[model samples]
Target: MSIGKEILFFFGALGAFNGFVLSLYFFFLTQKKYLSNYFLGAMLLALSIRITVTVFVYFNNDLPKTYLQIGLSACLLIGPFLYFVLQSGIHSIVKIPLQWKLHIAVWLVIIMLAGFWFPYQNYPILWNNYLVALIFFQWFSYSLLSGFENRMLLQKIISDYANAVPAEKWFGTIFLGNALLFLSYFLGFSRVPFVSCITGAIAFTFILYLIILVLMHRKRTDDLFVFNIKEKKLNQEEAFVLSQKLEKLMLEKSLFKNPNLSLNDTAKELGISTHQLSQFLNNNIGKNFTTFVNEFRINEACEIMLSNEKLTLESIGYDVGFNSKSTFFAAFKKHTGTTPLNYQIQALQT
Candidate 1:
């Protein structure tokens, strides 16, 4: 090999090796805290193994037939692992259900059938075709599922946590990266024999390393799953009672009239956890904390704008809990579809 080619080979091997090492790190060191992390670790491990073994097969065609068989056998695992990684990452579940074990048992049975059902030589070709077809189908189906999930997760993160830009960007990148990677893999598969894409494998190794690098740097990447999820924080009766109390507090004390009134402060007044209050808002009322508070401020501003002529828009905005005139104008326009001045003029005319 030329010096440049040798260099590429070295780095490719190094990256794939690092992916393997990172898998162990994720599984043992990081995954203990979350089942999502465990599944992600397993997916990375499967990816690393498949990539490494494909490269091994490509570089060493003279190697034993059974080694190829084992390599092909491991490919059976890749799609399922990716599916679980996506599921566990998005579901926020600490424990995956036992139903998945049935899939594993069935996959093992199919793999064993490949080993013993036919003559070793003929079974290799027939069984490999079955495995490849199954792998592609599994990947395609799960890609669709994850695409839908990624969209939902993105909406949830960006909606409830406006400051979660990093999470949003990372998720968008991950989704794009996976899509591009699979497209590359599928296209490359058609051009060459199943495992002979030397250049493709090297490029894929580099890309997978980039993803793993990002995943490692962002430790709480998986927390995007539960970032805005509405946990069942209160039963119907309790939620109703709390919601009533909150409304009473807002109405009687005019709590929303405080420019800096906060969910935590309100929660304290109500003697409930901040979590319960937040859950009540999202699950019961379908509003975020900012939106809910701003609704009250905007409503108060509207009432003042209509009923009293002495107060200027700025004074009215401040009186209704807005910290700044700009915020007041923006919130007024957002809630009422017009600027405060414009709304006042329109209200007078109507």
Candidate 2:
């Protein structure tokens, strides 16, 4: 091997080896089932195996039959493991349904066929090419399915958790990083490529590793779902009663008019946990706590706008519980599609 090729192989092997180690840590050492450790660990392990196989094929010049078989099997798993990662991360679900085993069954059949179907002696090159094509195609197909699944999952997560931090952006980096790795492989492995696949994949691996490092540096255990449902499902009557009680508390007490209002305080007043309140707002009201409170504040500000012509917009904002003029302006514009001053003028003109 050339000096450059040797270095590439060394780093690539190191990265894949590290990835495998991390996967073990995620699977067995980490005790938190809520973070989707098992699925993540499996996915990482599969990716590590594929990387390892690729390294062996590139430097060695000849692919061994057993190695080819194992690599193809691992590649077959990469996509479904990604799907499992999404499932476990967003919902904290560890036990999959028995029917979902259909995906596994399909992968098994593909592996079985690929393992046995080779007419190795007469058309050796053709079999090798066919296996590579099938493996890449399978990986790409599963990637597409995972992309769709991720979109739907993100929507559901946001819709279901009022307190959910904006995680879609961070999670998107995961998909983009994977795409970079795939592009590297495509360029390196395909007939249509000018660049070396090994080099590109290795470069992308460094980039991906940095991202992983950032994700792991979080102080809290990364629970994707911000709120846990004390009870899984709520009936219509129960939802209505809880919602009504919450509304009464907000309306009667004018809770939104407290400048330092917090979700915890409101939950405490209502005799429920903060997670429960978060669930109520998300599921029943279709609003986050901030949005829910701002609605009432904006409505009160409008009433004051119409009824009291003497108050300044800034003062009226403070009266309606905003801590600062900028915050009030932003919330006013968000809710009413106009600044407070503009809304007052527009209201008078009409």
Stretches of candidate 2 off by over 4 Å are: 1-7, 33-35, 63-69, 119-131, 152-177, 191-195, 207-216, 219-281, 289-334, 337-345
Best by lDDT: 2
In order of appearance, the predictions have TM-scores of: 0.60, 0.64
Model 1, runs deviating above 4 Å: 65-68, 118-131, 149-151, 154-162, 165-177, 192-349
**What is candidate 2's CA lDDT for residue 203?**
62
Which ten contiguous residues of candidate 1 have the minimum total lDDT? 161-170
Q: What is candidate 1's lDDT per residue for 222-254, written digit by digit as tens?
A: 443333352665778987888889888888999
Instruction: Kindly report which residue pairs in candidate 2 clash with one another.
Output: 188-197
Give the C-alpha miss distance for residue 259 in model 2, angstroms.
16
Cα lDDT tens digits for candidate 2, 16-120: 887788788777776555445676677778877878877887788666656756755777787777776656555546577676578778888877776677634
Clashing pairs in 1: none
